[model samples]
Each structure stands twice: as structure tokens, then as C-alpha cells.
Target chain A: MRPFLYERADQPEAAVIAARIQGQQQAPPTAAAAQFIAGGTTILDLMKLDVMQPQTLVNVGKLPGTIEMSDQGLRLGASVKMAEAAENEIVKRDFPVIAQALQLAASQQIRNMASLGGNVLQRTRCPYFRDVSYSACNKRNPGSGCSALDGHNRNLAILGTSDKCIASYPGDFAQALIALDAQVETLGPNGGRSLAFADLHKEPGDTPNIETQLQPGELISAFVVPTGAWTRRSLYLKIRDRESYEFALASAAIALDMDGQTVRGSRIALGGVATRPWRAREAEETINGQTLNDETARGAAEAAFRGAKVYSHNAFKVELGRRTLARALLDAGRMEI
Target chain B: MGFSMSQSEKPGGLNRRSFLTATAMGATLPVIQQARAQQAESAPADPRAPVDVKLRINGRDQSLRLDARTTLLDTLREHVGLTGSKKGCDQGQCGACTVLVDGTRVLSCLTLAVMAQGSEITTIEGLASSDGALHPMQQAFIDHDAFQCGYCTPGQIMSAVACVNEGHAGTNDDIREYMSGNLCRCAAYPNIVAAINQAKNEMRKA
Candidate 1:
């Protein structure tokens, strides 16, 4: 682990003071010399492996850790731990997709320590990016090259991949947030602002090193997920080699507003098969106003993966991802809401 | 008893160091191998300035100066002399470094010592009573033979206790799912589930 300076955060505005820069749009938040640390799960783990080496860390422990629900929707403070939000009564009852995504992620101890804010920002688990000994990662070392392109590409992304990087967005909760149309509130050196969750993550597009749209000093403050007719009917389904404590091989987050046996509306997001929390607008369009059935669900699933590009090892993901989405739709359709 | 070889491979005589290179001996890309190669010729990133950290462990406050790189697990083992918490995987992948921070289970390996200033940490050694009585979960593990080569037992026990407290141990399936964080290489999973079930009832009674 690299030695660095640590300062407890005084205020949101003050926290970013050290992190503020002139124009760092080209650099990822992980590349910032001074970064925010709350749960320290991602930053600490990567630092020990020498993946991320920030010169200074501003502890965000002083931020409010809260999960509150109202008539509008659910509001989760950035500091709320994954375990706390996963087991929150309102989240489990009103938004099963959010609850399931949090529950299925990481492990008991990791969920307890990791913050919901940081959970979405977790980097890919691409083996080449993790082990610095490889030295051929576009994300780790920009323009060095991508080893996963040819070597062990089983877990890489298919939906969002440039020739430079194929690292999949390794998060489930972000899929739920994107599907539910959550809005993220952020505090930066300039002040506070809100952005749609869908716009938060950037595609690899040649610059795999710059991951998020967040500025050098910006920090995620809260996530507000608006409730609707589909909120009670939503579910997140994850498929993996192991039942628990493992990253997703393929996953789906689905929310449907049903009109008896027909679908009134649909919201779909995919995971483990994309570069970011990918919104399957095509699948949602296919399912909306259509009668909910096995055949229709399969059609929507096929639409979801129509644009998938597969390499040598990860070609199975296109099929597996389709099945996972279809299964989520069928299961969610049959849900007793 | 901390040797890498687990002669008994049973309840009482499980060696903690069974978590070392013994099980991973012929594996490709072992973490230790990468760590060894990195240590010999890794990139220069060390600033190595000691920071003063005061931590409350098992109801006692201890103060020490440590590098910013020192994790809570290292502080407990090397600085404060609490070796009950093992470092199975120094990274957060394995839960062998599990401990309770402010009564909630967390991976000590991922928590930096300086950052854990205010929270009270409870490790495996703190589970026993002052009168020498073991925690119900510990007793239950012994009665159910929940471990063999008990390297991951501390983390498992800590996680199981938290699982029950968190009301995630309502059924056998719940126990299995919630306790999946702590990996037992000996595959003593069934026994661990039975132990958690037993202790859940006993803990409720107490």
C-alpha cells in the first residue's frame, strides 16, 4: 500500500477543496491526487495491489448516513452502508429491485462496510487491470494497451467496448438505479447539482482511463429514486458461477407496470454484460404495451442483446445475458405485488 | 498450532495457517506470487510517513503511530497484539480478517487503521466473557463441528453472529446465503449452518 496523508472531512464543500483542479476532465476520479474515502472498500483494496495510488485521502465519514422514503420516492444519503440500505424496510417492501441488488452484491462483511455511494463507482474486476504486474491495461495505464482483449476475455463487457478496453461495469446496484431512473445529487467545488444516474458513467470510447463524468472535486451526495407504478413490481436477477459472494456473470434489473395480463410500461437495465449500467431502451420498447408472456419476454430479451459484440471467450455472455433478462421479466411478471 | 499443516483436520486441532500457501500450492497466479514479484520490483509509490492513531479494541483504548498504509488488521495483529483475527487474503476477497466495527461486521483488512479512529472494534478474542465462558456462537461451533482446519473460523463466527443479529438468519437458506462471505476451504459449510442455527436460538434465549 502507498503511504499518504489523511484528513477527516469537515463539510462537503470543504472536502473537495483539496480535490479541486483547473481542468481534469481527461482524468478519472481514481486518478486524482486527492480523493474522497468513506467505506474505503474500493480505494483500499486497489491501493494494496498498487492499482490506485492517491497522494491524499479526505475521509467522508462526517457525511450523513441515511436512507429515507417519502411520497415522492426514496432518498439515500451517500454514506449509507450497503447492508443498511439492503435491509431497510421501505426499500425491501417498495423497491425489491434495489433491495435485491444490494443484497446480492459482495458479501456480508463487504456490504456492511461499503457505502452505497461508492458501490456504484466500483471499477471493473478485469484481472489485467487489477494486477499491475501485467502492465497492459488502458484503464490502469492509458494507451499502454489492453491485455484482456486477447488474454482471458471471459468476464469482459460485450455491449460497451472500444478496441482499447472491454472492462465491464462490475456493479448490480447501479443497474437498479439506472432502471428506476434515479437522480444523483453531487457536491463539487462549484456547489451542488443533480444529474441522471444514466449520465453518470461514461463509455470507454477510446478513453477508458476517464471513467465517470464527475469532475476532479465532485462527490456524490445522495441518490433519489422516484417511485411509480412499476416500483412495487421491480426485481433484480443475477446469475453467477457461485450462488453468493461472487461477481455477476450476467444480470438483469426489470420493472414493469402491468395492465392485468398486458404490460402498461417497462424499465430495463442490464449488468455483467456492459461497460456501464446499460439501459435496454430497445427491450423496454419491445415489452411496453405488449401482453406479458414467455414469448414476449424472450423477444424483449433478444432485443436487449442485439447489439452485443463478443470476443473469443465471452461469446457465451450474449446468450446467457438474454436468458437472464428473459427470466427476470417472467419472474417479475409473476410477482405478487 | 498455527502451522500450515492441519494434522487433525477436525474440530479442536485446526491450524490457522492452513489459510497460507498450503492450499494454494500449485495454483496459477497465486496472490502471494504476485505480491512477491511486486515487492521485489514494484513501482515507486511509498511516502511512508507515520500517522498517530487511537483505536478502541475489545473495550480498551490503545494509541500507536503507524504508516498511513497500515490496515486495521495489521494494527490489531502487529501493533495491538490481537492475532485472533487472521489475514487469509490481505485483500477484501476473503473474509478471514472479519471484525465488528461499532457492532456491525466489516472486513478489517480493507479498513485503514488511521481511518478507524472513532469506532469500537470487536475481534474473535473479545467474544469470550470475562468469566472465561465462550460466546454462544463459539460453543455452538464446537458442538456442531462447524470447522476443520479452522483458519476461517474467526471471520465465520463474527459474520454468523452479525447475521443472526441482523435478522438475516431466519431460515437455513438465509443463514447459508448471509454467511457466504466467510469461505471455509475445508468445506465445513453444513456444520457451520447447523452451528449458526443452534447459536441463533441460544442467542435469542440469552
Candidate 2:
């Protein structure tokens, strides 16, 4: 609850420019720094936990002309609420899986306030990391000992985890986007550029804080999903400890194109059990040229968790992940093309 | 910002309809003591700093700037003089603190007042008509008898409004799933479902 200055930008460029100016204005070793505010759900939550300390918050929610929808696909403003994006006619009709994922990801209230961009960028909800006094989260403080590596880590990562960090990417929407091969548009100091959605998240290797590939002073403007036959045949399956308002213990997003009864091409991504929105390339390859059946689906599912490594408390995730992926693929296969 | 509810607005002056309506809504709120009593005999010590907050409840932007640590639950009752929203767990586990931000329902205890600004917020107080007409949902709650102790009523009503708006009240199971976030200690879930069903039917009529 530290005091901080606030400014609402009228334009996206102005917000970016203001952020850059604020970053430059801060003298070395000074406390006066600015952070971009979008949705304010995750950032504020972290701030309350003393995980982030910024002197200024540049309000980017009111930035003009960021949301748009066209023949290209839905272009959601970075600040567009997750609930709105999930329920958008174009998204729900063209990509019901994405809609279902968002619907089941968070509670209705959180979905209402959380933005599409915010959902993609939400940090891990690791309890130890949020509680800074615990002194065991590499993501919160790099090079520090990871308490979760040995402690209660039932919700921690099972894939792409390192001895340094085992936190998972706790985003439901990102898995769907990765499955659809969405593109992310960002406006940085050097102007605008587009990146493959799947490439946005970096591996947890050493620096878990540097989670995404976006450069400093960069603002995500919109995310676009390209039109394809697979777009209409997508499904998101999340398995959590509870029925609602819970993060996935193991989730999968699947999009497939079928030729009669045979699988043509498919995109698969795993969530809650991986460090990133994991695209299951092995599973996709295994399912290709094969008909939709329990055996083939189970083989692809097995391929999805081929090299999954287990931690002290997360050994259950490997089996849960395999089953979740198998169920998602079979569900997608049942959809009418 | 200059608006405030009249200090003379007495909780006792509430009409029979209003009283029954509030009770109907309050009936949905959780009486935590009862819940704990039923759960078991085991007990454990709890340790957490209490944060104080002064929210601008309803139209009156009252400021009781508290311990930067008070929750919205303690803030409304202790500072802003509004007690419609109940505190079930003080944790985000229950949806008893559900209130509307602009038009969307949120767990107020989890939200800080400083974050809510320039948005036309509404609570159970603002959900009714100025002349004391009960909101359709309130009437529906009474008709459906959606509560037992009435502690969780306000939150249930608030979330019910949101559910209809979000189109999540389509079926009985849908209402049950969406309303799962709010827990009624009285185990009056059947009545709550009936209330939501009645409210959806009323909304459809409108």
C-alpha cells in the first residue's frame, strides 16, 4: 500500500511513450519508477503481497482504439476483459474451446475484470513466491533457493522445470492461443512488431522473472488468431481440485482438422503442468495420419508426457496430465468438422 | 464524490417487504460459526494481519482511511457504515463478499478500495429502487426461500444478478456451478437454487 503517482493514458502510444519517459526519468538507484497498469488484477494482487514495488502506475486501461474485430479475426485490446473476449460471438462460434477454457478458468467476477493480455501475462500463483518472507522462490528473487522444489509443490511444474524454478504458467487462455497458433502484437520503443504467440513465453531455465520475450517498455496492443479449419474444431479441457474458481492442476487445449475419420493435422498445448503453455509437438506428430480412436489418442497422450520429470509432491501430475491430454484429443475428435 | 447516504437511515425503519427481502438475501449469507461447529471438533490458531479500508459505499464516498490492512468486510461495517455484504471466511474461499463493480460481481474482500475509482459501483443497497421497491431478484429470493440464516443472502443476490448478466443462469446445474463460489453454511443450497431459478424466470419475463 505504498503511495504512488497515477496517470491514465489516452492513447496506446502515449502510454508506451510515458512508460519509456518514466523509465528514463528515474535516476540510478532511485525509487521513482513507472509500471504499466492493465486490468490491475494480477499486478495489484502481487503488490499487496509486497512482490512488486513501483512508485508510479501508468493506467493503460483507458487507452483509445485498442479493441477491434475484423474479417482477419477478433483483435482484442490488451485491456479487453477476459470475460468479454471469452464470450465474444466470433470467438465462441469460431473457437468454442477458447471460450470454454476462459469460462472455466476463473470465476465470473475475475473473468469480468481480467483482460486478455493480463491473462496471458499473469504470474504464477505459487504461495511461497507470493509470501516473500518465506525466502524460497527463485521467481520472486532470482538465485534464491526454491522451497517448492522440495516442499509442498502439488501445483508446481512437471515439465520444463529446473532445479532453480519449478513454477508453472498458470494461464488458461494461453494454452488455447498456443493451440490456435495466435499472433501477438506489441508496441515498443522501436515501434510495432508481431510475434508468434507460442514463442512469447521463455523457458524457466535460470531466470524465471524474465518470463516473456517482450523487451522493456513494450505494450501488447492486440492478439490475432488466424482463420483456418482447425479454428472451428478446438477444445480446452482443464482438470482442477475444485469445480469452479480454481487453477488447472492439469489442462489441455486441442485443435484438429480431420479428413473423414482420419486426423489430418492437429495442434496441442498443455497447461498447469508445464512451465509454459506447452505445445505438444510429439503428441501432434503421433496422432497425424491416424484415425481417431482410443488407442491412437492414448498413444498421442502418452507422447504428450513422454519426458515429464516429477518433483517431491508433483508426481501425480504426470498421470493426470496424460489423462487430461487424452480426454481433450478425444473430445476434439468428436466435434463435427 | 459529494454524495452520502443519510445518517438517519435506520436499519429498523426498513419496511416489512424490505426486511423480508434483506432477510431473504441475508439468508443466503454464511453464518461461519454454525459451519465451523458442524465441520468437526478440531481447532487451530489463525495468524494474519487485519487490513483496514474505507470504501465509498453506495453513493456516499465516506472515508475512514484505516490500517491500510483492513478488509472490505471490516471496512463497510466499521468505517463506511454499510453492512450488506457479509464476511464468511475473510479468505477468498466464499463469495459472501460479492458486490458489483460498475456492473460485474467481485469478491470485495479481495479488492482494495483504491483500485475502484471512477466506476459506478453498486451494492445490495443500490440494487433496489430509490422509493424502497425491492429488486426483482430480492422478491425472487423470498419466493424461492433461498436462504436459512440469511447471512449469505446479500452475496447470493449480488452474484445472482451477475450470473443472469453473464448468461450463466441458463440451467439448474449452471446456476449451481456458477454459484459454487458462494458457500451457504446453513446448507440451504436447494433454496438458493430455487431462488436463482425464479430470478432467471423473472428476468426472462422482463
Candidate 3:
């Protein structure tokens, strides 16, 4: 609990205004500076573990227009609780995959307090970053050598990973959003802008510390998922080490549009095995116009894992990833949509 | 001769210590009775800090003050003193902190007190009547003997309410998956399942 100023913003613009003022008046937080607080689920948990030490926590839960839903799809304010979005009648009925992904994620208690925007921005659950006494993490302290690259890379990413970092984005809701082609809306010093949910995450190349495209002093306002008839035909499949409350080893989110027995188009993204939301367009393209079968499924699965490069301890993830994709595809296809 | 000696004898037998003891007991009875009545009549202590909040809980207006970082679970337990909502794993992994905020079962540990300030919060304590009656879910737990150590019973009951509220309690598999957030380390799955079924029966009958 470092001493710092605290302010609550009532409107979205007011939130931006507050951040701008803090950045201007205060010295830049150097491992001891200011940081905006959302649900406090991820940040506070890390703070308790001493993994994150923010001097200032700008409370943004009271900002308006953060939670809303309409015919244009869902508009979740940065403060909207994960439990609220997951249980929205429209979300559950229209986007069952997203609902299921959220519900099956953390326990009911976490989902209740965690927000959709916070879920998207949650840091990697890489064991190295969480253990603070070991300060060899680039994400925790930029330019610090990553101990996870060679040591305990079991839960590390294979795709979009670099020598600087091998941390995986450990969010179930983000995977579902990536598969659904959702967009993230943000408010900053300049104003508001939209970002494709896929592009929201940056590759951990060299600068593993810079995780998202969000600029300094900018706050995520909402995440909107585009409406599609195939939305109801999507599925998120996660395979973890245990039955509950565990991060995934290899997970897949699949959205399918079928014409009779043949596939029309599909959206696929892999989680738990990638540095970002690992979208498999190559695999998706290979499956379109193709009839559903074990052979085609296996081929698409191979395409999904084509560029995967595993470390010493995580070579098993490539095969597991392929199986996860295959199974998710089959599951989506079996849906009687 | 006996009557003449009685006046002096009686006067001498009446000791100062005995007279004082009797007098003290007579004087303390009213004070003791008033203390007991006050103890029984005193309202449950308000645990919430004095922050103006108007939230809905179990379809009723709830007004209270709360700490900024106090988790919804803590607020329900300490502030509102709704102890039916148990705190097992405050880290949100254990479903022991489950409660319904606006009809959806959520983990209360992860939620902030201020965030749920205006939301409809339903805790396990509010599930039953204020007159010492048990909610059907509670009765189901008792009838089925769903809990062993009973530490996770409130969480189990809260999840059961949410399972039905979400309509995911239609089948055994659905109930298992929907109630998956709750964990009873005592391995009370069979009894939990029976309790859920009994609750469904009771709910349908209602």
C-alpha cells in the first residue's frame, strides 16, 4: 500500500480527464508510480503477492456508459462485472459460447467481481512473473532477463513468443472474444477509438512489457462484439490440468457457419499456447468448402499448429493444441444450428 | 423467662453481613433483567462503513455504508452481517464465496463492495425468512444431508439458487457443471446432488 492520490470519475470523459491530470501533475511511476484500477481482481491479487506495486490506484468503477447491451451487440463498460455480462439474457442466448467461456472460467466469486474490460487486460499467469522475489521477468521489470524462457516453460507460449518473454495471455473471455471478432473501444487523451480485439494485444517481441495497444493514460471504455447469425453456433473448449480453477494448457474457440454438411466459414483462435490470441485463419481457410470428416478435421488441426515452435519442456503442447482445435471444431459442427 | 430473653437474642442473631447480602440481591434483579432485555432487543450491528449506498438485495432496497476495498462477500458477511455467505477461498478459486448479484450467481470475493452498491445482491442469508424459517434450499441440504463439515454449505446453497435461477439445474450434468464453482472438500457430491434435486422439487411445488 504505497501512498498516492485517489479519485473517482463519474463519466467516461471525466475518467480520461482524471488520468491526464495525474500524469501531468505527478512524476511518472517508476515501478512505484500511478496505475488505473478496474475490477481490482488482477491488480489487487498481484499487489497482495507483491508482484505489482502501484503507488496510485485511480478507481474507475463509477464511470458511466461502461455497461450496456443492445441490438448492435454487447457494449460492456470497462467496469461491467464479468458475472453481469456472462449472465446477460441476450449474451447467454445469442452468444452461448462467450457465456459458457466466462462461466467456466474462474469460480462464481471471481466472475462476479471481475469486469469484461479487466478480463481482456488481465496479465499473464506466468508463474515467474507472479513470484516477485525472483526479479528476472521482463514483464515485471523491463530489460530483466526472462528466467521462464529456459526454466519452467511448461505453461509458456509457443506462438508469438520471443527470447525476451514466453508468457501466455491467461484469459478465457479474451479467447472467446477473439474468436467472435469483437472490437475494443477505448478513451484517451486524444478522444475515443476502436481497436479490433485481435489487434488489441501486441506480440511479446523484444518489448514483452508492452502487452496491449492501449496508450498511456488511456482507459478501455467498452468491448463490442459484432452480431452474426453464426454467433450462436460457436464454442470455446479449454483443457486444463485439473477439473476447476486452473489455467489452460491448450484451449480453442471455434465459430462455425455451415451449409448442409460442408463448412461455409469459421473463426478459430488458440489460447494457453500462444503469446496473443492465436487466431488460426490458415486452419479456418482450409476447412471452408470442405466436408466435415476426421481427415479434414485432422488437416485443419495440422494447419493450426503449423508455425508452432515449442521449448524444451512444452513440446507436448503442439500435439495437445492440435487435438484441442480438432475437438473444438467437431464440437461446433455438431451443434444443430 | 423465654419471652423475656427473645428480644435480646433475636437482635443479636440478626447479623450485618446477612442483611447486606439479602439487600444486594434485591437491588440487582431489575438491573440484570434490563441488561438481558437490551441484549435481546439490540439490532444486529451495522458492519458497513458509513458510505451512502442504495442497493437492492433479494429484491428489497438495502441502504448501508461500505469500505472501498471491502469485497462484496465481506460486506455481506461483516457489514450486513449476512453470515450465510461463507468465505472459503478469498482468492475466488473456491466457490465458497458465491452469491447472486442481480439473479446471476457470482463469486463475491472478487467483487468490490462499491461496485455492487446499486446492484441487486442476493446472499444465502437473505434466502430464508427473517422469522427463523429456512429457505427451501436450506431444507434440501438438511433433508439430503448435503454437507459434512458444513463449512461449504452456504456457498453450496448460494450456487444451488443460482443454478436454478440460470435454469442450468434442469439435468444432473447441467447441475454438476453449473454448480462446479462450488467445491466441498469433504466429497459431498452425492448429497449435494440430492439436495439440489430436492430443492428443485420444492421450488416446483411452490
Candidate 4:
């Protein structure tokens, strides 16, 4: 790891100011300056791999760590540990998909230490992305071309991909957040603001280097998920090579508000098969106002992967992704309340 | 246990205003006297300066002046001479460097020594009782033959203890899921699960 300045920030505003100051020191805005470190799971791992090199790190763990629930919905502070959020009684009862996604991610030890904000912003697990030796990664180096395009693309993205990058978003919780129409609250040098969870991550269209919409000094303050009739029925289904401690090969988050076997409303999202957290709006539209039988579930699943573009090595992901969605939908439909 | 920064008041009673003033001066001054004085004299010439870190390891307060790049794993094995925690991948991928920070299991290899300041850290060496009796988890691992090469034993034991404490050792599947972070290339997973279960029962009794 490279030598860097470490500054602990006890207050949220102070952390943002420190980051803004560090960012100004760098000549170019693109230069990696100050990064916020909460759990140190992603940042430290990338630093060790030499993939990410931030000159300064502002410790933002002291900002807040609350998981508040109210009539409106649940508000999860960014600093809350993944394990704490996953095991919270309100989270499990109100948003089973969120709990399941967090529980299914990484391992118990990692979940204990990783913060919710860091988890959502975690980088792709593409071997080429992690290994700096691959200089052709456009995400790592813009206009350098993507090695994973023809390289071992078995685990790469099949949807929301471009010629520039195909690294799949290897996270589970973000999928649930997007499905439930969650909102992200952020505090930065410019002050506080809220944005839809869908706007957090960017597609690898031209600038795969620019991953998130967050500015240099922006710190995710909290995530607010509005309560819905479908929230209780939501669930996340993950399919991986191993039953535990592994990234998903394909996963699905599904929530449905049903009226006597007919879908009154539906929200669907797919993971491990897309460039970003992908909300399957088309799939939801296909199933809404329709009965959630095997046929309808299969139709929705097919619709979810309709735009998937598979390479030679990842053609199986398209079918596997569809099956994951179908299975998740069926399982969520069978949930009692 | 008194290594917490929250417990230690600044000697000069510097408040937020004075701290901010010091930071501004440090940034502007080519050679800040106070900043230079705080750096470790033994630190090698490098762009990164050494930072003073205090940690409560095994219920004992310890202090070390280390470079900003030094990881908790390296600080323990190299500086503090507590080599019980093994570094498998030197990344967060492997749990060989697992340690309990403030009663929560975390990867010490990914954790910087400075970040662990003012936290209660429990390593493999701290697992046994003061009387030298083996920890229940350690005893169960021995009984179940949970390891072959023994390189990953310390981490496995630490994680197993945490898994039980976290109440994830109720059944075989739960144990396996919770203990998945600690991997043993010797393929001793079955034995590891058995050891964790046995230890859970023993600890419950105690």
C-alpha cells in the first residue's frame, strides 16, 4: 500500500471539508485525492492491490450509526455495519430483501465490519480490474480498452454493458435498494442533498472511470427506503458456486403487492449479470396486473433478460439470470405476509 | 483497555478551534516544528510519516509509532511481536488475519494500525486463559482434528469463537455459513464445523 495521510473526522461536515481541502490540493479534478473510509473493506483491499491510490483518507465512521424506523419507512445511517442492519428486527420484518442481501454477502466477519455506504460503492470483483497488471481495463484506465471483453468474461456483465467495460456489479444489497425505490442522502462540501438510489451508480457507457455520481467530497449520510405494501413480501435470491462466502453468479430481488393471486404492483431487480444495479422495470411491467403463476413468472424472467448481450463465455448467465428471477418471484409469492 | 483516544484527554486541552489552527499551520508551514516532533525518530526516510497509535491488546495497553501504511496485521506480527495472526492473502479476501476489534471480528490485514487506535483488539494469542488453559474453541479444534498444516488455525479459531458469540452456531448449516470467511486449504471444513459446534456447546455450559 502507498503511504497516505490519515485524518479522523468526528463530525460529518468536518470530514467533507477535509476531503474538499485535499481535493483542491490535487491539480486535476480526476486525480484521486481524498477518499472516505468507513469499513475499510473495499478501499483497503483496492489499496493493497494498487488498483486505487488515494493520497488522503478521511475516517467517516464517527458520523452516525443509527438504524431508525418510523411510519414513513426505515432510515439506515451510512456508518451502520452490514451485520447490524441485516440482523435488525425492523429491517428483517419490513424489508426481508435488504436483510437477505446483506446476510448473503461476503461472510459473517466482513458483514460485522463493513459499513452500508461502503458496501454499495464496492468496486467490481473482475479479476482484471483488481489486478493492476491488466493495463487494458478501461475502468481502471480510460480509453485503454477492456481486457475482460475477450478475456475470462464468464463472470462479467451481460446487461447494461458497453464496449468500454463489462465488469459486473458484484453486490447484492444495491439490487434490493433499487427494487424498493430507496433514496440516498449525502453530505458534501456543497451541503446536503438526496438522490434516487438508481442514480448512485453510472453505466460504463464511455467513461467507466467515473463510477458513481458522488462528488469528490461527498459522503453518503443515510439510505431511506419508503414503506410499501410489497416491502414485507420482498426477498433476495442469490445463486453462487458455493452456498456461502462467495459473490453471486446470478441473483434477483423481487417485491410484489398482490391482490388475491393477481399482482397489484411489482418491483424487480437483477444482480451479478449487469454493469450496474439493474432495476428490471420492463419485467415488473410485464407481471403487473397479472397472476404470478409459473407462466407469468417465466414471462417476467424472460423479459428481465431480454436486453442481455452475452459473450461466448457468459451466454449461460442469461439463462441462469432468468431462472434466478423466476425462482425469486415464486419464492416471494409464497411468503406468508 | 485504557488505550482509547476517547479516554485520553489532550495534554494541552486543545479544542476544535486550536486543532483546526494547528492543521492549517501544518499545511502552510514548510516544516512544522510540532508535526516533525510528533514523528517517530526511528522511522525511515519516506514520504509518509509515522503516526503514534495506542491499542488495547488482550486487556493490556500498548503503544507504537508506525508508518501510516502499516497494517494492523503487520503491526502485530512485526512491531508488537504477536505473530499469532497469520497473513494469508495480505488482502481482505482471506480471513487468516482475523482479529476481534471492539468485540467484532474484522480482517486485520485490511485494517491500518492507526485506524485500530483506541479499540480493544483480541488476537489468537489472547484466546487462552491467564492460567494457560486452552480456550474452549481451541480445545474443540484439537479434539476434532480441525487442522492439518495448522497455518490457518489461529484465524479459524478466532472466527469460530466469534461465530458462536454472534449466535450463528445453532446448527451445522448456520455454523458453516457464519464460518465461511475463514478458509483452510487443507480442506478441513467438516472438522472445523464439528469443532465450532462442540465449542459452542462447551461454552454454553460454562
| TM-score computed on alpha carbons, candidate 4 | 0.92
Model no. 3, DockQ:
0.08
Q: Is candidate 1 or candidate 4 better by TM-score?
A: 4
Instruction: List residue ranges in candidate 2 displaced over 4 A.
Output: A24-32, A64-72, B1-79, B87-93, B109-115, B142-145, B148-151, B203-206
Please give the TM-score for the first chain of candidate 2. Answer: 0.95
Q: What DockQ results do all the predictions give, each relative to the true complex? A: 0.21, 0.08, 0.08, 0.29
Worst 10 residues of 3 chain A by lDDT: A23-32
Task: Give per-model TM-scores.
Answer: 0.90, 0.82, 0.78, 0.92
lDDT of 2 by residue, A154-236 (tens): 99898888888888889899998898888999987578999999899988888776788876557888888877878899989
Alpha-carbon RMSD, each predicted model: 13.0, 14.0, 18.6, 6.4
lDDT of 4 by residue, B31-71 (tens): 23333343332122232767778889999999888888889
The C-alpha local distance difference test score for the whole of candidate 2 amounts to: 0.74
The segments of candidate 1 whose C-alpha lies over 4 angstroms from its true place after superposition are A21-26, A70-72, B1-47
Error of 1 at A10 (Å): 3.7
Model 1 DockQ vs. reference: 0.21
Share of real interface contacts recovered by each model? 0.51, 0.12, 0.20, 0.44
Candidate 3 scores an iRMS of: 23.8
Ranking, DockQ, top scorer first: 4, 1, 3, 2
